[model samples]
Structures are given as C-alpha cells and as structure tokens.
Target: MPTLTSHLTSHPQTAEAYTRATQSAFLSLAGQGRLPRPVLSQWLSQDRLYAQAYVRFIGGLLARLRLPVAKAADAVEWRVLRVLKDALDGIVRELAFFEDTAARYGLDLAAGPGEASENSSAGFGPNRVTEAYVDLFDSFGARHGGAQAASVAGGERTLLEGLVLLWATEKVYLDAWTYAREQGAGREGGKTGEDLDGGALRREFIPNWTSEEFKGFVDEIQGCLDEYAAAQGGEGVQDRALELWKHVLQLEEGFWPHVNLQDVASTM
Candidate 1:
C-alpha cells in the first residue's frame, strides 16, 4: 500500500514542483561550492528564524497527540510522541549548529526583523516566502494550543493535517539537500571522487544536511505520518493531506527563488 507521501508525490503537478525545488540553482550552487557567502549567510539567518517557529510547531503537535483519544493506551500515540520529542531535541541541536556556523562565517545572528540589518544588500530581512512559511506553522501551533490559544477564522486544523505538513516539510528538505549532495558529487566527476574541496559551506553544511542520521530523522517522521494516516483512513482525510502536501511543495519551490534572488539586481 502506498503511503500518503508517496501518493501525493506521485501526482504529476506535485512531482514537477518537487523536482524543480530539489534541483533548484540555490541548492545546486551550495552543492557545487559556488553559492556566495552572503547568500549562504542570509539563508542561515532566515532558516534560524524558521527553526525557532518550528520548535513551537512541534510543541503544538505534541500537545495534540497527548490529547486523550478513544484508544488512549495505544502504542502508536506513544511512538509518535517519542518521535516528536526527539525532533524537538534535534531542532535544539540544529539551532546550535546555526549559531556556530554564523559565528564562524561572521554572519549576524541578530539580523532578523527587529535588528538593525547588516547585510541589507543580500536582502537580510525576512521576505514574503519566509513570512508565509512561518505563518503557516504559527497558525497551526496557535490552533493546537501549543503556546497561546487563538481563534482560527476559517476553521480548526486536524492532527492529521499538522502531521502531513510536518512530513512534507521534512521530506522536501531532506530530498533537496540530498539532491545538492549528489549534484556536488557529480561536479567532482563521481560520488566519492573528492571532498567538496572548498569552504565550510561545502565541508560542513552539505554533509550535515545529507548525513545518514539526518536521513533517519526524516524517515522516522514519515513513518509516524504514514502510520497515523493508515489508521485514520478516509477520503476526506486523504484529500486534506493531499492539499497540504501540494501547498508545501509550492511553498518550497518559491522559497529557493526568494532566497537566491536576494541580490538579483545587484548581481545584474
């Protein structure tokens, strides 16, 4: 039986967008050791901001999972909760990596919305793409009572919806970096031909992203998502999952362009 992720990724439109995103020039340059330092710095800053929001998002998902269901004693919930807890821990480590990377690169860790911008030429503020992505996570967190209970004007989201979003986001991220790694390897003429042969962007960031441990983390999330979806099977459930899946791919596709084009006019 196909997992919900497989079903959604198999869709023609979704597949195309996903492919474009994984093969994006932003990632390609990073892999090839060609992405500018300013761009990488900008990305690190924006991603750090996103990671903070993600911690909140995961917290909300954990809260929802803790809610008593009919099968309150089932092992599935326990397993999923455990995975979310691990994810929370993983994000903390990831944030630490970001801070260390920023310090090593001389990138500003305080260049977000409220701070005086240092890399304005690289568009060092949160752009529309980051804003929209963060909003989606924040909205879901708010709806799920992770931090503060807020009214969702349209309607409340489901645990399944949140899980799908999480799965989609992580899956895309893993695949994108994997693609970058492969591309970088190919540019060197083979998978094991040579190291990235450049700076920290190649030596540290790419390997950290495409490492086996990171891949395992992504797989665990997918497994949790698939198990939940299988148990909660329904057309409506699948439909909603599919919608969120497509929406995430679309957002991811746009994300690369937004970050890469930060200094577009200056470059030209």
Candidate 2:
C-alpha cells in the first residue's frame, strides 16, 4: 500500500485546494473591510458561539469511542478522531478569548443557545449540496455500527469517514471566519470614524495560516493518513480519505465567492 502522503500528494489538485482555502481564509480576515464595526463585532461574537457548540459536539463523539487520545497509532483513522477532538478543545479556548475581546470592543454576540435542531451546523446552510454532505457524514459515522457498537472489525473505514468529516468542518469554519473577518474590517478608518485596529481584530479572532495549528493540521493529518495506509496494507482506504478531503477542498475553494458580497462589498 502507498503511504498516506503518497496518496494525498498524488492527488495534487485536491490537496492544493485544501491548503489554499486554509490560508486564503486567514488572509481574507486580514483584508476584509466591508461592514460597520458594530456588525462585524456582533458577527465575531456569534461565530465564537458557533465554535463552542461545534467543539462540544465533537467531544461527545470522542467520548463515545473510549480511545485514549495518546493512542499508539498515529494511524490516520485514529488521528482523525484525535485531531477532531483536539480542534474542538482548541477552538473552544480560542472562542472564549474571542468573546472577551469582542465584548471589550462593544460587540454583543449573546444569542440564546439555539438548539442544534434550529441552527444545525451540518452545512453552510439548508441547501441540497450541504444537506447531502451532512447525510454523508451521518451515514459514515453510523456505518461502523453507531459509534459504540463497532469494533476494529471495520475501524479503517470509520477513520476514513472521520477524516472526511474533518474536511467538511474545516471548509465551513474557513468560510464562516472569512465572512466574519471581512465584516469586522469593513468600517471606515479615520478619527471617530472607525479607530479599531483591523489587523488586531483579525489576529485575535483568526488563526494564522502559518501558525503551528494550521501547519500541524497538514503534517499531522497526513501522518495519520500515511500510518493508516501502512496498517491497512492497501491503498483503497487512503484513496477514499483523499476523495473526501477533496470534497472539503472544493467546498472551500468555491466558498468565498458565495460569501455575502453585498454584506462586505465595501471591504472587498
């Protein structure tokens, strides 16, 4: 079986897109300047809340697995879950910091915790493509016999699916963060006009593409992918993970174009 890097590196177009979206989202936050300060501040507040909920959900899934986070396999399948869990924890911490900052800047993002039923994070919104993607992950998770029921009898497939789910989430967070950043910096800049340091706003809320978190994501996930490929003794599972990763890459590549241009037109 080819190594995980071999499978992912072989699929240049998909990998490139994923990498690009990750960075572009960060840059977009830095460059965005289309909305009033108040609106952008509120958006940041709402986004942080969303992050909190997302991490909580991921935590629940990890808790169901009973897998020690420091497991021996840097296996792509296990790593996918571990990374997802790590991301959730990290995002939760980051959101708390962002909330305090947004509030200091006079943004009110206190939305009553809406039930996931009312505000599902399954997709960009209620649409055919997003709905399909959500269904795909749901099926993927249940495919291993509903989380707790399955054993290593089909662990490989479950891990690949989790990686796909990770891709989907990264794609969405990229979009949402881009939207929030653009809005935050859209205010006019001048004395009493909008004295906010837009760069500071971005730095506080958006993760730097070059930061350890982003770089580690590529390296670690790839490592996991490669490890899984080696253990499975085949390339089929690796290919599937790559395919799902592509779905997310494409989603992000096409995301900014769909961002509310009208909402942040001034900053664009």
Candidate 3:
C-alpha cells in the first residue's frame, strides 16, 4: 500500500488546507500570547481522561479480533493494528503528562472514573458539548467494531478515520498548549519562575505540540492519509473519502472557538 504522504499529496488543496489550518492555530498563539491561561490549562488537564477513554475503547475492539498481532502482514488488518498501536502508545504517554501538569496546577487529573468503571459519564463534567463528543465516539466505536481479516488488502475508511481522529485530537491539544504559553509569557513578561526563557517556556508547556516528538507523529499521519487517498478503487469511494477529510478540516477549524480563550486573535 502507498504511504499516507503519497495519498494526501495527490490532493494538494485538501492537504494544503489541513496544514494551513493547523499552522494558523499554532501561529495565533505565537502572535497573541495574551489569551487567558485557565482556558488552556483546563483543556490540557482534561486531555488525559479523553485519551484514556479513547484508548480503552480501541483496546476493547482490537481484543475481539481473531488475527494475531503481527500476522496480517500485508492486509488492511495489519495497517489498522499499526495505526492503533501508534495512537495508543502516544495516548498513554500523554496521560502521564496530563497528570504532571494537573499537579502543577493543583488540580486533580484523576477527576474521571477509572478505566474499569462501568459508568461512562463518571468523570465527565456537566457540559453538553463533551457529552455529545463522547457519545459520538462511543457510537462510532460500537458501530465499527473491529477490522476483519476477510476485508480488502489495503486499509479501509475506518482506519483512515482513526488516523484522522488521532491527528485532529493531538492538534487540538497543541493549539491549547501554544495558546497557554503565549498568554502566560505575555502576562508574566519573560520567565515567571519556570526556569525557561520565553520561547523555551512556550515549548515546555506543550510537550507533544511543540516538541520534535509530535511533529514526527503528525508527519506519519499525513503520510497515511496520503496513502489512503491514493488507494481509492472507485470514484464514489474516492469522493466520499475526500469529503470526509473536508468535513474533518471544517470541524477542526470550528474547534478552537469553543475553548473560551480571551485575547486570542481570529483564526487565519
């Protein structure tokens, strides 16, 4: 199968829009840096629970599959496993970061019910937005249970959807972190007892977003999407997939508006 980069490269407009939107979110923080810190802090703090829930859901689905972990070799099953594994690994590490940041802010990172908890709503706040988002994820998971070995050789739309979810979620976190760093540095005017210079402090607050680690991750995701786009067998499938990406791009553009960050400029 082709790599994600190849698929997205074939649709330059879509790929450019995706990159541009992410860059706008990143640069907005770099420019303003005057938005409220609590808005971003709250978001960074809640990410752990969301990551855990998503991980738990995916793990459950994977466990129900019959194929061996690495046995699928050249099929869609193998690609799905690869994507899921990569996502879960990142989520686990991010959960740890959330815990540390929560402690720094004197907030409880463990606000959500544990993974073993039966009630899905245990850790969630009273916000209708999060409820809607979580319910959608739960529904999506339930509807698309697992990748079957009998499916096509290349990966399916479900796998591409997963990659898109991973990319979009991480981008959201990065945006919040950059926004927080900018606001913190702007208000404090320099270092604010954090032992980091203004630019360094910006990097420190948002690990995945600002670090080399997540940039590489994003590159992999884009590559996967590019591959998916190239593997389309029919006009209907290709158009549908492109449309799905367009929807994702629009959703991402709308995401930051809900975070309630003050002093942040309009999106690019």
Question: Which portions of model 3 miss their true places by more than 4 Å?
Answer: 1-37, 60-79, 107-129, 142-157, 167-189, 192-203, 228-235, 257-268
Number of the top candidate by TM-score? 1
TM-score of every model versus the real structure = 0.81, 0.55, 0.59
Error of 2 at 78 (Å): 7.8
Which candidate wins on lDDT? 1
Better of 2 and 3 by TM-score: 3
Instruction: Between candidates 1 and 2, name the one with more favorable lDDT.
Output: 1
Clashes of 2: 8
Worst 10 residues of 2 by lDDT: 111-120
Candidate order by lDDT, highest to lowest?
A: 1, 2, 3
Cα deviation at 18, candidate 3, in Å, is: 5.0
Q: For each candidate in turn, give its C-alpha RMSD to the true structure in angstroms.
A: 5.4, 7.5, 8.2
Candidate 1: where is the Cα deviation over 4 Å?
A: 67-74, 110-124, 142-154, 186-198, 258-268
**Residue pairs in steric clash, candidate 2?**
4-226, 33-185, 33-186, 33-267, 34-186, 34-267, 35-186, 76-224
Residues 24-141, candidate 3: write the lDDT tens digits.
5434554334324444443343444456567755664455334446644665445556656787787787677666655664544435433432232545452233433444344335
Better of 1 and 3 by lDDT: 1
Quick one: ranking by TM-score, best first? 1, 3, 2
Q: How accurate is candidate 2 locally (lDDT)?
A: 0.49
Give the worst 10-residue stretch by lDDT in candidate 1: 145-154
